[model samples]
Target: MVQPNPPVLEVSGLSMHFTSGRGKKKTTLKAVDQVSFSIGHAETFGLVGESGCGKTTCGRTIIRLYNPTAGKIMVKGRDLSGKLNKEERRFLTDNVAMIFQDPIESLNPRMTIEEIVGEGLTVKGKMNRAEVRRRVYETLDKVGLTQEHATRYPHEFSGGQRQRVGIARALINQPSLIIADEPVSALDVSIQAQVINLLNDLKRDLGLSILFIAHDLSVVKYFSDKIGVMYFGKMVELAEGEELYKNPMHPYTRSLLSAVPRPNPLTERFRVRVNYDPEAEHDYTSEQPRMAQLSPGHFVWCSPSEQQRYESMMRQ
Candidate 1:
């Protein structure tokens, strides 16, 4: 039997809660509530949800942009949740990179593409100017930008070109795990395809594990090997991309999938939107729900009774 490669990213019971006000007036918002998932080497794990579902917050927390209130984050076998030592900090910087959502907002207006892309290497203080420039050119070339474009400022380039510059910056570090928070959401449809294809090629060539966060399930389904659907602050459903599309067990997941527009006119005319009401569909007053394995590689957050109902539905 062939053994599988170890997971590149592992998160368990991750939570990020924001607190406001003082004393009796304090209120806590659970931005990410006990979320857990894993990403395999060279695989894409898509986190899909509606707006304000904590998808972006989850991605930010994993990369230590925000200190997690609860849970453990193990990236490349190193614990990243707790306080970091110098080496741990170095490890995080060297092995992980992030691609932000807004292309224009992410890039600095004053900096040329060369300066922006090479900043990571320059900050390391290890590579000299010549080395950084050379690497920046090579990285730009990898992302389909020519050396000539490197001298131009962000304002000089189109939206797509600017996004490519962002991608080049992320690639400059040669990271193993990339947390892409809606990397293509801001681009035009044509531009989105180009960027996604570039990312696919890079993932194949570099064997990089990607945590892709997006609100569009159709986009996630196309790019992800595994898909996890989040609702509000919890992961409601998770399975292989195709599996989740074919068999969405949770009411919230079903509602989300039902909203995806169809290409065919006939299908579009007949598409019925599913409205999900948690309070109406679930009787959680008696028993609390938890993430349970309903089948191989499939999990749903539900109580025992709900699991039984889902299992029966799957059988049919």
Candidate 2:
């Protein structure tokens, strides 16, 4: 029998918690709880949820920005859940790069585009000025920026152009996985499409795997091969992009889908939004719900009875 290939990135039972205050006054926030999923080589895995739903926290935790409270994070089948040596830390940093949300905030106001894009190369060490300049120019060109733009600072560029700089910076390192946290959210609607198209082209050209994190379901549907819907800190539903959009089993997932505005006038006029309240949606006081495989490559968090209901709904 042949063994299956491991995912480029896999996360299992991952959790990140934060405590504020001191002593009894301290409050513990479960920023991310038991999140699990994987991204295949060259695949785009979209994570969608509302603000404060732990989507960004989960992405940051995967890239080792914060120490996980529990669970495992595997990069190309190599476990990164444990403490790492300096060498391991450098390796991880080189392999996983992040594209932050706000372009202006992410880029240094004082640094020119060349310095911003080539910073990763500098951190990796031993590159002379000319070598760093060459890679920076090459990466900038790839992201639709010219050599002229490289001489300018972040404040000199428009929001869209600033984001292009961010992309250039992420691509300069040639990372295996990119954690893009709401990359286009702050841009104008027209600029959003341009940036999205640029990312799609780059992904295809680079054969890159991305963990695309955003609150917009429509954008995620356009970008992801697989989609994971997060609520609070838990992933309530996981499925292929089309499957989840067509038949969302979890109540929270359904509620989220219903809220996305449609272009059709009649449909938009008649659509009723679904409001999901966890307390009203589930009876977790008695039988607990575990993540269940509802179908091939589809998973949902539900009790046995709820699972049966979902199965029956699919049948209908």
Each prediction's TM-score versus the true structure: 0.97, 0.97
lDDT scores of the candidates, listed in order: 0.91, 0.92
Model 2 misplaced stretches (Cα beyond 4 Å): 1-4
* Cα RMSDs, all models: 2.1, 1.7
Per-residue lDDT over 211-233 for candidate 1, one digit per residue giving the tens place of the 0 to 100 score: 99998777889999999999889
Q: Candidate 2 lDDT, tens digit per residue, 111-205?
A: 98999999999977879989999999999999999999989999999999999999999989898899999999999999999999999998999
